[model samples]
Target: MPDVAEVRRRTWVPGRPVDVLATLGPLRRGAHDPTWRVDPDGTLWRGVRTPEGPATLRLSSRPALGEVAASAWGPGATWLLDSLPALLGAGDDVSGFVPRHPRVVAAGRMFSGWRVPRTGLVVEALVPTVLEQKVTGQEAYSAWRRLVRRHGEPAPGAEGRLWVAPAAVTWGRIPSWAWLQAGVDGARSATVVRSVRAAGRLEECVDLDRVSARRRLRAVPGVGVWT
Candidate 1:
C-alpha cells in the first residue's frame, strides 16, 4: 500500500454555537456507514469523495475555547480543510425561517446548532439514495457497507479504518453479480450505475440553485419525485 498522506489541521470559531451532530448527521448514510465515525468525545470524522481524491476530515469543537478544530488527510486534505466552514454550515442562511408557532420556536431554540450543510458533491447524495429506493433500510445500509469496504481506499490516519466512497469510475465499474450479492436488485443497481456514468453532468447540478438541482437530478433515469 502507498504510505499514508500527511495530516493537516485548521481551527475556527463559529459566529454562533455550532452543534456538530445536528449539522453533520445528514452526511452519514446510515448507522453502519463506512464513510463516517463519531467518537465519544464528540469529534466527527468523515471520509469525503472529492474530485481531486479521497479525503478524510476530523472535526472537534471546544466550546470553552470558542473554536472548532478540523484535521484532514489524504490527497484532498487541503481542499477539505479550505471548505470546512461551508461544510460546518457557514453558508446557510436562516433569516427567513422565523417560526410562528410557540412549539416550533421552542424546537428551533432547542436545536440551535442545526444548520443545512451543502456538500457540492452530487453523486455522493444520489448513489445511496438510489440504493435506498424500494428496499429495506437494513438492506441498503448493508450493501453500502460491503461495497465500500471491498472497493474503497482506507481513510488516512493512524486510528479509524474508515473508507472514502469509491471514485465515479470505480463505482461505475462494479459488476452485475456484485450488486446481486449485496441484495441490490437490477432496477436499483441500474440506477446507481446510470448515476455514476453521468457523474460529470450530475456534479454540475451543484452550481444550480436547489430547485434547478432537483430538476437536473430528476432528469436522470430512475430518479424521480420521491428521490
Candidate 2:
C-alpha cells in the first residue's frame, strides 16, 4: 500500500555455496510465523521492516545456473535488494573453523552451504527472542505469531497472508492487555517494551565487540544469560 510498484530484482552469485534456506531458516520464529513462508516451488518469501520501510522479499535458488534470484516490493525494496548478499551470508567468514569431532565434521560436510546470516536488525531480532525466554517453543512461537498478526501490517506484494513486524515505536506502545491476549507474560512484555525504547543503543551492538555487546544486552532488565 505504500506506493508499491513493479518488482525490483537482483541476481547474486556467491563465491561459496550458499544454502539460502539453511542460512535464513533460523530467522523463522515458527511454522506459522506470519512474516515467513516457503512456497511449494521452493521459493522463500519474507516480509521485513527495513530501516527504509516495509518490504516483501522472494528468493529462489537456481542450482543449475549457480545463482540466486531475488525480487522485492514496497518502499524498502531497493534497500532489501541491496542487502541481499549480507542477508544471505556473504559476510560470514568460516575460514578458521575447524571441526574436531566426527559428528561435527559430518555435520559440516552435510551443511557446507549453510552460513550464518547477518540481518543487522537488532530490535527485530531481540523482541521475539525476549518472548522466547523461559517458555516452551510452542508458547513463545504462539505469542509471537499472535502479536505480529495483530499489530503488523500486510506485506506489500506477498502472495499469501504475510505481514511485516511492527516498528520499534509500535512495539513499545503495545498495550498491556494486548500483550496479555497474545500469551506474553508481564515480565517478557516489559522487556520487549524496554528493548524497543532503547533500540538505538541496541542496534549499535552490531558494531561493537562480542564482550561489549553481551554486556550491553545484559544491562536490559529481564535479559540474562539464557536470553
Candidate 3:
C-alpha cells in the first residue's frame, strides 16, 4: 500500500471574513455529496483527487483569532495544505469589478466575504462542464456525484467518508455503458473520454493565460463552448 501523510494545525487569517462554506461550497457536485461535508462544529471538509493522490481536508474558523485552521491527509497532503489559502479564495481579485447599480453594490456589500475560488485542477473543473453540456444541472450533478462515489478512491483521512474524483486514466477508461448509466449521453461521454486521454496537455494549460487555455481546450475533439 502507498504511504499516506497528514498535516495539521496549519492556519491563516484573511483580511476579511472567510465564510468557509460560502467560499468553497459551489465546488460541491451536489448538496448531499460525500466529497464535501460540514461537521457539527462547523468545520468544512473536502476531498480532492490530485495528480499525486487522493486527499481530504478539514477547515475550521477561529473567529477570536480571525484565522482558519487546516488539516489534511493523503499522499497529496502537502499540496492540499499549501494550496488551502488559494482554494479558500485568497487569490481572487475583485478590484476589476465595480458595481454600477445600487442593487449590485448592495449585494456585493452584503456578501462581502464571498469570493470565487480557483481549484487549479483543470481536468477536475472540466469534467463537470462536459457532463453539463446540453443537460439540466440536476442531471449533471447527479452523474458527477454517482460516478465519483463509485470510481474514485476513498480519501485517506478518518475524519469522514469522502471520495475524490478518479484519476484521468481512470476517467479515460470508463466504459461507454457506465456513462449512460450515469445519465450522460454518448456524445458528452465521448468528449469526456477523449479529453481525459489528453489530460496531461490540458492540465499543463493551467500555466497559460485564459485565452490561450481556452484555445487549447477548444482544439480537442468534441470540446467547444458548450464544454
Instruction: Pick the winner on TM-score between candidates 1 and 3.
Output: 1
Worst 10 residues of 1 by lDDT: 1-10
Q: Sorted on lDDT, highest at the top, how do the candidates line up?
A: 2, 1, 3
How close to the true structure is residue 63 of candidate 2, measured as C-alpha lDDT?
A: 77
- The candidate that wins on lDDT is 2
Error of 1 at 90 (Å): 1.5
RMSD of each: 1.9, 1.6, 2.0
lDDT of 2 by residue, 9-102 (tens): 9999986677889999999999999999999988999999998889999999987888999999999999999999999988888889999999
Superposed by TM-score, candidate 2 places the C-alpha of residue 218 at a distance from the truth, in angstroms, of: 1.7
Say what the RMSD of model 1 is: 1.9
TM-score for each predicted model, relative to the true structure: 0.94, 0.95, 0.92
Kindly list the per-residue Cα lDDT of model 3 for residues 1-227, writing each as its tens digit. 24564455588888778888888877877777768888898988888877777888889988788898998888877788888888888989888999999999999998887888877798988888888889888998899988987788777874447777889999988898898998989998888998998999999887899999999999988889866
Global lDDT of model 3: 0.84
Which regions of candidate 3 are displaced past 4 Å? 1-5
Model 2: residues with Cα > 4 Å off, grouped in runs: none
Question: Quick one: how many clashes does candidate 1 have?
Answer: 0
- Judged by whole-model lDDT over C-alpha atoms, candidate 1 comes out at 0.85
